[model samples]
Target: MILAETLLFALALIDCGAILFLLIYYIITLSDLECDYLNAQECCEKLNYWLLPKYIAHSFITFLLLFHGQILLFMLNLPMFIWTTFEYFTVPRGNLGAYDPTEINNRGQLKKHLRDVMIYIGYYLIFFFIYLYSFILALLKGDPIRRGSDDDIVTEI
Candidate 1:
């Protein structure tokens, strides 16, 4: 139980870190796009670099949670995992995969992407809090196994 808790805590920590980094990157990209500092193709290309790793990490976390019988926790993140996985497969890879580069303007697409990122950022923040609470509760509860004591002594014939 302790092992499982520890592993879950570690994985959640890593996931939270990834979520933070992603949130920052997304925000920067959105700002740059809005300010005309970064072109649509460049934004997509930069974000492309993060897509696969985020998907892989999310999948691993979901798998680990399922393996450990964390059904509730697993369910909470299932939709996000499924959505990301689906996107990973359906979306084109590399430059301009997320948007049509030939389009005269990508402002609308960038706005939509920003909204999606904000939603994910909120979801991940909530999930991180839940994971932190679970870890703390597990620590407080402690192990079920009692420490060694002089209770029943073995007798030799």
Candidate 2:
């Protein structure tokens, strides 16, 4: 149980780090697109590079929590995972898993995408906090490993 909790914490930590990176990247790219500093297709392509790995990491953590019997955590994360996964699969593909800039006018797509990214960042922040809480609880309650009794301790002399 401790092992599972520890692993879950570690994986969640890594995934959260990736989410932070994506948040930054999205903000910058979206700003650049707004200013006409970057081409829409090129910007989307760069963002697309990270999408698959993000999806994979999210799914792995969700499933790990489920299989480890962390029911509450699993339940909390399941809805978002399912919603994002469905969005990922259902979106039109020619744009490379990103919103097609031409589909919306007045920079609406960019603004909407940025808003969505922020929401996901917020969700991840809460999710990470929950994982951290569980990990700390496990550590506090876990028993220390004992290799041998006190009699087996070797004296410095």
Top TM-score prediction, candidate number: 1
Off by over 4 Å in 2: 1-3, 93-95, 104-107, 143-157
In TM-score terms, candidate 1 sits at 0.80
- Listed in order, each prediction's TM-score against the native is 0.80, 0.79
Each candidate's lDDT (Cα)? 0.75, 0.75
Per-residue CA lDDT of model 2 for 18-37, tens digit only, reads 77677688778878887889
**For model 1, how many clashes?**
0
lDDT of 1: 0.75
Give RMSD to native, each candidate: 5.9, 4.1
Model 2 misses residue 137 by how many Å? 1.9
